[model samples]
Target: MAVHGTVAAGFEGVCEEFASFLEREEHDPGAQLVVYRGGERVVDLWSAGVTAESLLAVFSSTKGAMALVAALLVQDGVLDLDRTVASYWPEFAGRGKDGITLREVLAHRAGLVGIDRGFTREELADDRRIAELLADQRPFWQPGQFFGYHGYVIGALVGEVIVRATGRTLQEWYEERIRAPYGLDLWLGLPESEEPRFLSTLPMLTTPEQQAELDAAPYSRFSLGGIAFNEHAPDAVELEEFVNARPVRAKGQASCGGIGSARGLAGMYAAAAFGLDGRAPLLEPNTAAEFARIHSAGTDLVSDSVKQFGLGFNTIAGSFASVAAGSFGHSGAAGSLAFADPRQGFAYAYTRRRYAYPGGAAPENAGLLWSVARALR
Candidate 1:
């Protein structure tokens, strides 16, 4: 397997590591990796099966972008983190949720994971519809008492807050304030003109043993993880199939509907932390720190495992020790990981075309990220 694209001085190790990882893969895991250092594109590489410009559905990594938009609103005083969600969207105050703050909702503490009856595909892809359904539903737990990853509906929840506050959608705010201004390849909603650039996400190809392991898992459609992902929905489809649809791509549901390349992912974070092409960074240092603070840390109720979360970003410092404290980002279901290490002054993004074994961020990210960290010294 050949690794393509260029790297800046002192970053050749990232290219070698990427190539070695690709060579070890049993399948053609087409992937893209891009990094930015202090407003400069430092590393740009992708495997042969995919191109630099390929727009892949980056699963939950989309959440990082949504979180950024929310952070911007907070920074601008358009939204207040400490304020109750009911203050912005009165309908959200139902069923003991009157006290759920904007901060708690962003931290995945509101427990509005999914609706009583799971959403249809159309409702799932439409932020407005998802919010409408969830506003009246009972939360799974007391708001802020426990934190679970709201896999599918967190965006609809946050987007609803943005809608009630600004009278416009988070998707629209993301496009106007972040994506378009930075010329990011990432899209909250992909227009028809860009359809030709999309590469449909592929499902994981697993061995018989791996398949057996997956089947043996005790996950149920009614379990917290299942409902969080809407597996309980009558019309539920595999996550890969969700964004592969044109309507999902067009709507770009904030939770998981993002479409972009590694370039866009890296660029967005770079613009957030380091500024881009002579423009100012989107977030001030204080605002970034506030969002990156570990708001929730422990066993995530949805995943049933230890995880760390900031306002909306996954705090990376806990798991990846080399990552400096306050480093933040989110990983996608298809093994995409993107983040900004403000302490290191670099932003990194890695995306794969195929679902990675064991899901979440691909294991290779550690070695790849470590290589970049070493090169920065």
Candidate 2:
């Protein structure tokens, strides 16, 4: 398979590694990888079925963008991290959740994963509807006592807080403050004009053995993990189908409704951490440091896996040995990963059109990221 796009002279290894990964794949992953080294894009590469400009649905990676918005508000004194979420959104106080702080929510410890009945596809597309549905529901755990990957509803939970505090939605704030200013293609809400650029994410192609493993795994619609992903919903949509719908893209649910390319993902982090195109970085050093600090580290009750969360982002260093300890970003269900390593002075993003087996930051990222890191070093 032929790879397209250019890499900076020193980063030829990243391009080679990307090509090798694609060559090994049994199918076209339709992947794109972009790296920014301190405000300068050092690598831009894409595999077959996608161009650098093609926008793809990046699942939980959307959470990173949401977290960035929250960090901005916290930095601007518009939202206080320590303040109880109920203090801003009174309805959120229902069901013994009055003490959960904004900080805890960002750390995935607020325990408002999803409603017991689950959400319809339409409800999942609308953040306001989701917030209303969950406001009075019971939390799965004691507030702030443990952390879990909230998966689907975290954005609505956090977005509700944003609405009550700033009188605006997370998508609005993101467009005005982050996406528009930086001209980043990463979008909280994708407009119709941009719709033509989006390519629907393809499903994972698993082997018979892989299918058997998936089938054998314990899963129930009512389980914590199931509910977190909204599998409990009567009209639940598959992860790929959820974002493929036009309504979901238009509303940009904030959790997994994000649509963008590797450039857009890399640009957003670069703008936040290193400034893009000569503008000053959107986040101050202290702000970036605070968000990147590991807030939750342990076995996640929902996913039942050991994970490290820095605010809303996965601590990239923990998952990828090549990155620095302070690195932070979120990975998508479709094998996309994007983050900034402030300590190492680079921002990196990788997106794949086809879902990778066993999901969440495709295994290829381990080698690809290592190549990028090695080049930088």
Candidate 3:
């Protein structure tokens, strides 16, 4: 098990913890991790079967980037957090959703998590199509009355608002405003030239016991969780099936279509909260604070788990104590986690090629993050 890459002084424990975690994996989990304290790169490492340069499907971690774009719009006065979403996209006002605000949607409280009719794979991969379908679809719950993790459709919901307000796609704005200026490896829409570096996300290899646990609690495709992930579609596919498609990677659906290495993920957050490459931080401290404040908490209706969200990003302090509050980022379904812990003065990112058991953030993050946090201390 060859682990590739580097760490600055005081961060050797992070690498050791990573190696220890890998030793227990039953499969080659192919992972990358990169961290930055302020603008300086502190830890940069990856396991075999992946490299520092490989671009893996980052799943919902893409939402962090999408959220950043939305925050930028809010900061720029192009988008208002408190205004009705329908005020920007008139069609969104239909189906008793006229009152849903951008704040609620960003907080995953809109209840327009999915369309009852289900989305075609094509529609799910395209933000515009997804929005069109959802505009007329009824919400499963009263708008703004509750919170559920809108796993797959959140980016489309916000991206539609962005497009309506700016007359530009989220991908286009991301490229010009964030990715290109920072020279980030993370891409909302990967170009043809970058294909060689793109690594398709691998599926999870579950043990029999783990398989049984999943099988025992079967969910109807029409259930809120199932619908959020588009599992109800006639041609429903695994999470990998959607991201592995070259078309999806190329178009880069904002919710989960991003592709990048751990370095990119960490860099994105570092840039947002701290200056990078001799530049000013992308977000003002006031702006970052507003977005990182907890907007939703307690049990998540869709995932049926304890979760919390700020405006558009996941808060860091709740379940994972290693990172304190006032931090923000997101995890992908393939065990990827990326966030900036402003309180701790570092941005951390970990991404896996092989899916971790039970999905979302990988179980190994605790040790890795704890080690990094200790090293920083």
lDDT winner: 1
Candidate 1, 111-130: lDDT as tens digits:
89998789998899898999
| Residue-level lDDT for 105 in candidate 3 | 97
Instruction: Supply candidate 1's per-residue lDDT for 309.
Output: 95
Where is model 2 more than 4 Å wrong at Cα?
none
Screening candidate 2 with a backbone cut-off below 3 angstroms (N, C-alpha, C), the clashing residue pairs are none
Taking the tens digit of each residue's C-alpha lDDT, what string does model 2 give over 9-126?
Answer: 8999999999999889888899999999999999999998899889999988999899989888988999998999899998888889889998898899988888888888888899
RMSD of each: 0.9, 0.9, 0.9
lDDT of 1: 0.92
RMSD of 2: 0.9
Scored by CA lDDT, what does every candidate get?
A: 0.92, 0.90, 0.91
TM-score of each: 0.98, 0.98, 0.98
- Candidate 3 residue-wise lDDT, 67-114, digit = tens: 999999899999989999999999988879999999999999999888
**What local lDDT score does residue 53 receive in model 2, on the 0 to 100 scale?**
88
What local lDDT score does residue 290 receive in model 3, on the 0 to 100 scale? 96
Looking at candidate 2, what is the lDDT of residue 136?
A: 77
